[model samples]
Target: MASAMNSLIPAFTFILALVTRMEKLDLKVQSSQAKSIGTILSITGAYIVVFYQGPPILFSRPLPNLHSFSVSLQSNWIVGGFLLATSSFLISLLYIVQTWIIKDYPAEMVVTLFGCIFVTILSAIVALIVERDPNAWTLKPDVELITIVYSAVFMVSIRSVIYAWVCRIKGPVFVSTFRPLGMAFAVFMGVTFLKDTLHIGSVIGAVTIALGLYAVMWGKANEVQIIEENVISRVDSSSDKVPLLQNKSMEV
Candidate 1:
């Protein structure tokens, strides 16, 4: 479910960018048409993953046999799906906010540091509210402690810095185009490490997401090429006119 939601991040980001006027859409342009179609496909694939878990194609162990639609309707699963979707949207929003900040501040490390600081504070507050037992706060010198330190240093801190720098260079929509890749990684890790069941729906959805990602990336590349070409043409025209103006000045 979380992986499915991850696939929707790019679609959400594109929609938000369009709303904010950070992204433009022209139906007449092939690049824009490709982007729009890709967004639709990405979103459609996500929903299919969430709601239609077809038959299990591969499973390490025998699991409960229930229809895909029934599984989706479970109250707990519904809540989890909602939360995952909300998280994906928030992640996209974070990308947009980071892009906006980086444009003005132009300091990736500083922005990452402040973002981590605020996140830590908010997490502490949430932890305090949710975990009433004092024993939960104890940090033992074990693998759990090591994992926490590793995540804090590498996953949160280092990842944030890299993402901020990328967001500064590329727009938020560009950064979001990679979200579908995480879904692939997550599926591989879960199936390999946790012996999770792999279903036909998931496989189909993942492939659809990949296709959509490719289309969107191709469109973006074309757009960049067009922009560069326009810039070069303008410069050439300006230079050509400069010689004509010089000749006119010599005649005068």
Candidate 2:
């Protein structure tokens, strides 16, 4: 499951970049080079996660041990893959829902109240249904609960509201660059909080991913420049033609 999440993180990032229009590698851009770079980055990230992270976890201690190949095939990988896929689907759905709902509403209020209400209800339902000990839900210290609440509020509510307003004012390239910044944050957090040993392969992988993201952004900026240049060129040509027409009219 952890390995699956590692793969999904990059996939989610790519999806978010497209949906937010931060990078354009589509047919309208007519740039095969841009599309190829995006594909390479995505595939490389997926391959890294699958080869480096997936196998270790799949064969490790936490997962249930199956005595036979048939049992392992039936019980473990298939179910784990399905859950990971479902998680990706749900994250996409959440983004879509939040985008739609906040389109007409004040982003802050919409994110805060709506998110809080939904999470509270959902958590309560889950606690009732699945928590073997109902009191386990209430056993957390007030400080811990407050911290969780604040983090949730900030992540889903405050940050999202800010992002929407930022998107409106700054445009896509600015927003997209923050993704690499986020990857940097992940590296920092892993080193600090988790005390995870930084491997050479990990550093190389991060650098590769960062470079790929930058290439996609570079392509977008190039496309934008081309569009502006074309518009300016047409305007200049039209202006020059008008003066020639005026000169001919005077001669006539």
TM-score of 2: 0.60
lDDT tens per residue, model 2, 1-252:
544344454346446656765445466564436644654564464445334532121111322343335433445777777887777656544544455455556465656576768787998888788878856767476888988788877876777667556444433333433443454457556656655445444455466666666665676567767888999999988877657778899999
**RMSD per model, one decimal:** 4.5, 7.8
Candidate 1 residue pairs that clash = none
Q: Give the per-residue lDDT of model 1 (tens digit) for 1-252.
A: 666677778888998999988889999998898888777777766666667779998886633453334434436887888999899899999998889999999999999999999999999999999999999889999999999999999999998888899888768877787666566556667678767888887788778777777778788888889999999999988877757778899999
Candidate 1: RMSD over Cα atoms? Answer: 4.5
- In model 2, the worst 10-residue window by lDDT is 54-63
Clashes of each: 0, 0
TM-score for all models, in order of appearance: 0.82, 0.60
Best by lDDT: 1
**Which regions of candidate 1 are displaced past 4 Å?**
1-7, 62-86, 243-252
